[model samples]
Target: MPEPIADFYAVIPAGGIGSRLWPLSRADAPKFLHDLTGSGQTLLRDTWDRLEPLSGPDRIAVVTGRAHRAAVERELPGIPDKNVFLESEPRDSTAAIGLAAAILVRREPDVIIGSFAADHVIRPAHLFDWGVRQAIAVAREGYICTLGIQPTEPSIGFGYIKKSSELIVEGAPEAALVERFVEKPDLDTAREYFADRSYLWNAGMFISRADVLLAAIEENRPELHAGLIELAEAWDDRERRGPVVDRVWPTLEKIAIDYSVAEPAAAAGRLAVIPGHFDWDDVGDFASLTKLNSHGRGNDLAILGENARILADTSSGIVVSQTQRVISVIGVKDIVIVDTDDALLVTTSENAQRVKGVVDALKLTGRGDVL
Candidate 1:
């Protein structure tokens, strides 16, 4: 017999413009639609597929911008038309999640909800499923459950979650009470966090019941919660959706769920962190893409380059073009060389974080042709 299906709903936020991954990931097509892992499946498709066993197609909802609706629909055909919630304007993650919570509250008030980013790449599907199951049970108990990745390095790109007391869950690893939430720290601070062994990298994956999340929002950000409740009531009117969403979204403060909700919830003793051992990467910037990319012994992704020497200590390279083109490099190391139909990017690996700078310059110079 097949495994029992878990009763939960999933919310995927895919509203990022992904300027750092330009040329391949553009305004018309975000990074979630691109196959960053070269697994033939886009990141959005991968995320949806991972949640199938837990929630199935009907329980999945995608919250994205109006500009990305068609792309999302084309990528995931299994999702129903009503499940795709579009924002009138681009808002921060807090508002995006508030809209999702409102939608969930309308349909199923007591339902457990899992909110995640659409572009994260996590491996070993079974491990992720297990983590979700544990979180679901915790959420059922009316506590906010967040998946916290065990930090493998003292990297400064991600925020940290400090755990205080341990709560034992039957048939699962120990869940910890979140003592504090720390922002991205410098190298010295990161090393201290690692030495303490009480910190976990905040993966930004959250699970909670609809009412539970609404209550948290109400307690932390009353204005945002009120606006969401109003939108939820007006959503069925059809005529009110456009005007209400337009007016309310701009007025809602632009804050991340971590700062606006999770931190405060932790301080109030309503937060728990589940140990997430899955191989996960947010793939936030171009530098992260390199670490997640597939690279062999010498970290080389060679394409149409004969007698070329490409050496890299890290996984960092992608080459794409329309026609057969002869490209060669000699005695080069630690760089990203992307060759597209109309554009090419050649930058040192260390400068990968500044890839967005190039995109901004292109936009400023009015080079719409390449962009």
Candidate 2:
């Protein structure tokens, strides 16, 4: 077992609604609160399990929606009430992570903060530990370090990080200066990037000193930096915190950290990439969710829920049930059936990415009750 890194703090941003994985994932109850992997642990809990060993319980914080405050608290009992940063409204990653950084920096100026997403899946815990150690080493050297995953295929689903010359940081020998961050590309471009050893999948796992990150954000996004700093100043005041957050948070810019910090940092040669050698997945859609389930992969099908049985002949797909009903499929290849008490999602693995469209339609039709 690896010991906790000294002066290390972890911030988990768990705010997204995950519309793509709907029926199973809802607005009030996001995918992170459920065990999509059938691992008997919710994604949020699994994240805590992996990170608690590195930062220790007291050094970890979670930034989530106000509506999810209770659920997040219930899921992560080890975290103190103050460590749970609840947003008045979703202001995207920049604000979520920025506020966390600002508060932690105020608490401890020299603290190294690592921002990890609440719903990602990383395996072989030991590899994750080593990668984090490398990132921390690079971060301590005043570089904003990101753990870039080794791309296994030409995946157009994720952003890519272009790595430049190797960074000779003492403790992190394999660290590389990041060239730039590329958005999701065309399939042809993805194939080109995949063949190149210089590219890695951008998992958005950033490790840096809290002050360093806040400084980068301040340089790149002054307005957001000011608002966050203002909020952080009042964070510890019981009476003033609520009023300040309500007044300033919504007015803040709604931009991702990539736009507000990482891109600018990369251009200025302040960003470093530590190649991560762990199995990881964001579990963005049902198709990827299918791959995570042991029984759902390969020969036949994947099924979620303990008593949920399925009757199928010559079919290959996944079935997730919230109720104790037997789902049957016939001659349907690559099918996906998600049955809940209120809603049922029936589609193919090919159409997995389009699931978000359904949620949008629901909102348009004023059917948010089902959402």
Which predicted model would earn the best TM-score? 2
Extract clashing residue pairs from model 2. 296-301, 296-302
Please write out the lDDT profile of model 2 over residues 1-371, one tens digit for every residue.
Answer: 87888799999999898999998999899989999887898999999999998999999999999899999989988789889998999999999999999998899999999999999999988899889999999999999999999998899999999999999988897899999999999999999999998999999899999999999989888999999999999999999999999999999999999888899999999999999999999999999988888443565888888678788888887999898788888888889999999999999999999999999999999999999
User: Model 1 lDDT vs. the true structure?
Assistant: 0.80
Provide the TM-score for each candidate, comma-separated.
0.91, 0.98
Clashes of each: 0, 2
CA lDDT of every candidate? 0.80, 0.92
Q: How many backbone clashes does candidate 2 have?
A: 2
For model 1, the run of ten residues with the poorest summed lDDT:
303-312
After TM-score superposition, what is the CA distance of residue 172 in candidate 1 from its true location, in Å?
Answer: 4.1
- Cα displacement (angstroms), candidate 1, residue 8, comes to 0.7
